[model samples]
Target: MRSVYMDHSATTPVKPEVVEAMLPYFTEIYGNASSVHAFGREARKGVMSARNTIAEYIGASVDELFFTAGGTESDNWAIRGVAHANKQKGNHIITTTIEHHAVLHVCEMLEKEGFEVTYLKTDADGLISLKDLEAAIQPSTILISIMAVNNEIGTIQPIEEIGQIAKKHGVLFHTDAVQALGKIELDVNKQNIDLMSFSAHKLYGPKGIGALYVRKGTRIKNLMDGGAQEKKRRPGTENVPGIIGFGKAVELAAEGFEENNARLIRLRDKMIAGIEATIPYIRLNGHRTKRHPGNVNFCFEFIEGESLLLSLDLVGIAASSGSACTSGSLDPSHVLMAIGLTHEIAHGSLRLSLGEFTTDEDVDYVIEQLKPIVERLRSYSPLYEKATGGTR
Candidate 1:
């Protein structure tokens, strides 16, 4: 069986150049970035260079960017930090119903602490209403947290417009850009994005490394306590090799950003068109165009998503039903529910995300295999029989 990976949203394979850049950091340049020795100085140089590269890529200042374990930690620190620091000022927060668990779960925690949270709804396309966002804001709403892109449906949120609304209402805006970095354009200043979260592994960099962009003068403080590392905002010994890998990945992404997007979009559309033309009773999730370039999602009526995933895997094609973080759950995707999908329809969904390594042949293989898989699965479904009026 020929292997094909179509789950880039879950994670990506580290590129060869990124690995090469990280190796030296693991061996020769092994020193705590906080140490005062010469070895530490060498390590510090590398760490600073990595910081500069990432900071530059997002148009943020080096001082404003802080390293975290990954996207989860970044989201937690941003939401909790801002909410805690501004407690005296307000106890209300505004976020969408379709946020990742990192953001939604934090909001839930804050709610238990007596904070009021407003979860804005999304349309069938998984897009939050900007007017609704503005209207949801109260004088006591201190923060507005939204993800830059929906991880499951690949819906690109209106970050700039949301930022403008947040700014107008004097509410702090934080976006989980873990899915947006390296694939889409991002500028903290231009987008008015006060705080943002990112992960390296989502963009072909090493795992366990991520960054948080905190614009200067944001009314937020440290959530964790310990050493004076990370400007005392996030304190701990840094992961040197991971930092090096993330930096190199960001550098490569910057250089080939446009060309990479063009290729992924082309291949993405090819696969999407193939699935649409060849498959039946399928509903495409998310906006047709205002989405992540490599994202392609569909819900096959009368077919279960997990069964489809398993069948695809048997043929050496890896895919996803929804966010990897919640893959093991028996519950339907909250994102799909927010977009008005019933439990049955959402359970039949499949997400086939492309990436830098995805090729034309790989996509072709999936489409060819998918038709038979769906047909075989639906043949066993009583729902299929009823829907088709016994016309199998």
Candidate 2:
């Protein structure tokens, strides 16, 4: 069987070019970026070059970008750092009901520490209401955190609008753009985004590397307190190899970003059309046209998502129900629930995210295999039987 990978949201395979760029750093240029010797200067040059490349790609200043372990660390630092630094100004932070666990759990922790949190609700299309956002802002509200694109349903949030709202209310705005980087056009200055988190692996770079963007004059406390690295904002020795890979990936993404998006959008639409034409009683999740170009999510009622995932794996197809971070949990997706899906419907959802490596053949293969898989799973489902009145 030909293997097909449709779980780009979970993680992406490192590209060849990225690997080639990273190889020398791991062996030839092995030196601590924090040292003062010639070897250290060489390594520091690589780090600065990578930082400039990423910063230019995202329209941020080099000093504004700080490297981290990945999206989780970036997000945790953004939320905790901003909230703590501005604690005297306010005690309230606003977010959404469907954010990634990194942001959601951080908000929960802050809540336990006496910070008030307001989780805005999304409509059936997984969109937050601008009116609700404006209404939620309080005199005590100091920060607003939202993801650029949802990991599970792949809904694109109105970051620009949210940013404007935060500005109007004098609150800092942060966005988790791990899923949006490279797939969409993002300029922090144009969007008024004060803070943004990103992961290298999501954009064909190596894992264990990420970055956080902080606009100039933004007040933020350092989560990692140590060396003078990252302008004294984040400490610890930088991952020279991984940062090189990320820079290479960003360079590749910038070369033909629009062209790649057009190709992926066509493939995604083809897969959605094929699956919708063949499958019955399935509800498409996320906004039809407002979602990411490579995202396709669906809820096949009366089946379990894990079962469907395993069945697909057996046939050499890899997909996901939500974020890789939340896999193995028996509970239904919080994102699905936030969009008003019942537990039964949410449990049967599937997410297929494409990437640069995804081919038309891969899309066709998944559609051809999925029809039978859904039928097989639904046949074993008592809920299906009861819903269909034994119609089969």
Candidate 2 lDDT over residue span 222-263, tens digit each:
977899888888988889999999999999999979999999
- The global Cα lDDT (0 to 1) of model 2 is 0.94
In order, candidate lDDTs are: 0.94, 0.94
Report the error of model 2 at residue 285, Å.
0.7
**Candidate 2 runs further than 4 Å off:** none
Model 1: CA > 4 A from native? none
Instruction: Tell how far residue 145 is off in model 2, in angstroms.
Output: 0.4
lDDT of 1: 0.94
Q: Each candidate: RMSD to true structure?
A: 0.7, 0.9
